[model samples]
Target: MKRFLLFIVFAAFVSPALVSAGESGAEILKARCASCHDLKGPAPATIRQLWKRDAPDLFYAGNKFRREWLVAWLQKPVRIRPAGVNYLRTINSTPTHQEKTKKGRKYDVLWGAVLKPLKHVTLSKQDAGAVADALMDLKPHTALVAGVTLDTSKKVSLDAGEVIFDKVYGCTSCHQIEPGYGGYTGAELYTAGKRLQPAFMLSYIKRPKNWDPKIWMPNLHVSPDDLQKITNYLILLSKEDFSESN
Candidate 1:
């Protein structure tokens, strides 16, 4: 009884601290992100401007980003999206629209080009760490997924998704989806659905090279069924209740 009481007391105290920490993350995001984002308006114009960029649909931040990745992102952002030169007939090695549209290149040329390290174009180490816990709590009001699985329900087969993820589309060559693939040219997708929406994934895949054609990742062929299967696989990879924890 005494131990339980102490535990309850600790929980009571810690919960408030956790609340305060969450508030701090909101503040930090405001100070760092508000100028560039508004969550409601004309959407962003450039991925760089935050105000201009339409990359992150932060309305789903809690749903999409992992606590650890979000924190690290604030400190040393890793570019999740590769370059963008698809629509434009831009010249060689010329910065793609995606690259041009983002807000940090000035920071890059001025602050990051020095190649200090941890090259994601947004946030410093200290700030990044602070944002993690807060961001995790920013969950959407939606209820649940009934626990996506690899072996149980027969809606989609994990092996099928794996086939599409690695073989048919050639996704493994650029993006790292699992421990097996060795590609590092693009952002890692090992936990994509955990951090991104299925619709968003579909759109991006449908138009892979559009944002940055010149970017190293080549837009490859993908079928609608394959896309759905892959999306299912991504969701499976992202969830926590599954038996096959990678």
Candidate 2:
């Protein structure tokens, strides 16, 4: 009986400390997330510098991601960019033994670290909320996101959007429209509308080079008309419940 009472007393003291640790979002991020991601940034200035990047910069995450998306992603981490953050590090020239595609094309394949499953630090639901709060606190690029707004006046059907992405811009070569439906270099487009702020999307797509000078995403030289349509399409696409279909 005396041992049981002592054990209960220890648990009472330790449990509160554990809860406090879970609530320390800023501390958690500094300790855990600071290693790979750039919490502070002036994005890569040269191609060499870009290739050296180990992970995405989170300095502008507040201007980039939706809070709910951030929370959920933290709790159950998944690979958003298929070729990984630094594709230059992940890609390898096609091996001689590898079979060619039906079109007889032999393209480069992803190798090295990305070949393994995502290596992000997963968090408990409570900790995820705390970490997300800390991430949202980082908004260094307010000027970049300023005055940018989604052009809701434009409307494009899903079929029309696909044509623009696949045929017009050739975006399907990198980004996926549905699960496993496109190349493995870029992020999945299906959830972008929900995950990203429309303003950030518009700005980033307008000139990815401006956001990250050495990023593999090129300046598509997209016309304003097409830009509005593309942003509209992304918003429409985000409305679809991909989880249900997948």
Candidate 3:
């Protein structure tokens, strides 16, 4: 009965375009996304005075996330939180992923297999390629980093983006910026401003699969204004360095 209820809830949130296992995080989160992920701003804490909470925010997912990872993770969250973000068990941790032995509850996950679900409907090789092209297509806000020279119209601002960058989204963990900012799993993004076509990037941010099939990342609700900001910010970095055709 519980699982049946879960399935019903799952169908409500997942994208109709996505083919699921009929039981995957994509389905669950998509159904219940509004409860935890608020796009208007940083997700609200349960309390008026509280600023932090347990789950990660999804509002700024457009600015972060690798498309391939996002698709797979949604289809099978066994790699993202292992035991599940809500449960915190590491039930599916791969031998290759980072371990929690050193930090107790503070385990750091650096990498995992590109998710491949035995039960779910996955993107075909051709579709996968199209999606990857689309994902690599995202451009962040074209703002000036402290040391980088990413100024296109000279109106881009990274200061206001601090929350979206470091705290609200934790983008620095996977993506890399040139003068600074980066992570391990994703490609370098300092030059994302110049790498992608503005129009293409726009399509991808709005509908990510216009670029790639996700693995470790999940689709988060995004608004148009935020998309413009991230696009502008990425363009700025393009002034310093970037590539879209690759």
Ranking by lDDT: 2, 1, 3
Number of the top candidate by lDDT? 2
Ranking by TM-score: 2, 1, 3
| TM-scores for candidates 1 onward, in order | 0.44, 0.86, 0.35
Better model by TM-score: candidate 1 vs candidate 3: 1
Model 3 over residues 1-246: C-alpha lDDT tens digits? 999999988877775545433434433444545465543343343443123333444544444455655554444433232223222222334655546674554344533232332223345444444434443333342231122222235344766554455565566665665533455445455645434455545555556533333323344444556656666766665565333432
**Candidate 2: stretches off by over 4 Å:** 1-20, 103-105, 244-246
The models' CA-based lDDT, in order, is: 0.53, 0.85, 0.46
Clashing pairs in 2: none
Candidate 3, residue 199: how far the Cα is off, in Å? 1.5
lDDT of 1 by residue, 1-246 (tens): 999999999999889545544456667766656554443333334545432343444554554455665765566554443322121211133344223435665211112222233343365555566665555565552332223222323246567777778777777775766643545446667668766655556545655444333334455666766666777787776563432533
lDDT of 3 at 84: 32
